[model samples]
Target: MIRKANISEIDQILAITKACGERMKEDGIFQWNETYPNAEAFQKDIERGELYVYISEDIVLGCIVISTIMDEEYKSVKWLTPNSNNYYIHRLAVHPKHQGKGIARKMMDFAEELAVQKNFVSVRLDTFSKNIRNQKFYKARGYKQLENIYFPNQSEFPFYCYELPLKK
Candidate 1:
């Protein structure tokens, strides 16, 4: 089941982030390297009410961060429509052991439901260029790709933005 992340789940979230970083490195995914998604960032996200975790049988299996809108850093991107309340999803991580079990999809479904409940018009997210599987996955789920955007911290790597309209 997916639920709001509490302070106690921070360590597990960090472990999952580290595992994901390691796996991505081994697999040549270029978004997260040695310095991204650290514990401090996760702590900030949790404190800001943007973190959510997927749990199963009392074990955390995945986590994601959602926001009503992105920071000013992403304002240049044209993917996300300028609306008062559009949901933004970030840091979507699934435990390596529990992958391939449709957990991420379920989490996404929950996100959309939340957006609908909140009366948001759409949902937006981004994926690393090297993460081909993610691009395809999001595409299959009705998320259309926008222009590639560069991260100031990692200018060498670019990310593909995606958006999905939630209006029925």
Candidate 2:
């Protein structure tokens, strides 16, 4: 089951995030190396009602954060269309032990469903250029890649922004 994250799930979320961060670092995915999605940042996301968790049989399999609009840091991007009603996705992480089971794709489907229910037109996300697997995953899921957009923190590394139009 996938649902909105509660405050009680913070510890588990942090553990999952730390593990994912470590693996990304070991695999040379520099976008989220040490500072992108930390515990404090996720806590703030939860407090702001942007975090979502995927659970199965009482265990969390993965998670992601969805927002109605991005922060000012992302506002400068020319490709990021300013649609207040569109959904923005970030901080997607799957438990290493639970990977290869399509959990991330399921979470993305859930995000689209939520966006549709909220009357949003589309769902947007950004992934590091070095994370080829992630880029392919989104592309396979029907997200279109926008050129020339980079994450504010990782300016050294460019990012490919993707958007999936949601059904009304």
Candidate 3:
């Protein structure tokens, strides 16, 4: 089940984030680090009602943050879709054990569904440029690669943004 994340689930959310971070490091992806998606971040997400979790029988399998709020970095991108009606996806992760079970796909479907429901024109997100698996995943889902933006604290390489236009 996919639903809005509550502040009460902060521990589970943080655990998921930590596990993902460790797994990424093991796989050589430097997307999240010691300072990212921390407790405070999740708190703010919950307060803003932007965080969602994928659960199964009361166990948290993954989480994602969907919002219309654009980061200053996104402003410089030459997006194919109009920026006005787009949703931004951030900190999407699935527990390592729960991966390969189509959890991420389900989450993406949910995000797009939410966008349509909210009258948004598209979904926008960025993946670490070095994470080929993520690039392939989004590409296969019809997300168009836009341009690269850097996170000085995240990686030496740029993060590539992708946009998927919703069917009218």
Tens-place lDDT digits, model 1, residues 87-133: 88999999888889999999999998999998888899889988998
Tell me which of candidates 1 and 2 scores higher on TM-score: 1
- Give the TM-score comparing model 1 with the true structure, all chains together: 0.93
lDDT digits (tens) for residues 1-168 of candidate 2? 888898888888877877887787789877665676777888888888999999999887788999876756556655444566888899899988888999998999888888888888889888889898899999999898876465666558788778887665
Better of 2 and 3 by TM-score: 3
Give one clash count per candidate, in the order shown: 0, 0, 0
What would the TM-scores of all predictions be?
A: 0.93, 0.89, 0.97
Ranking by lDDT: 3, 1, 2
lDDT per residue (tens digit) for residues 69-133 in model 3? 99999999999877797899999999998899999999999999999999999999999998999
Q: For model 3, how big is the CA root-mean-square deviation?
A: 0.8
Clashes of 2: 0
Error of 3 at 88 (Å): 0.4
Off by over 4 Å in 2: 79-82, 152-155
lDDT of each: 0.85, 0.82, 0.92
lDDT of 1 at 128: 90
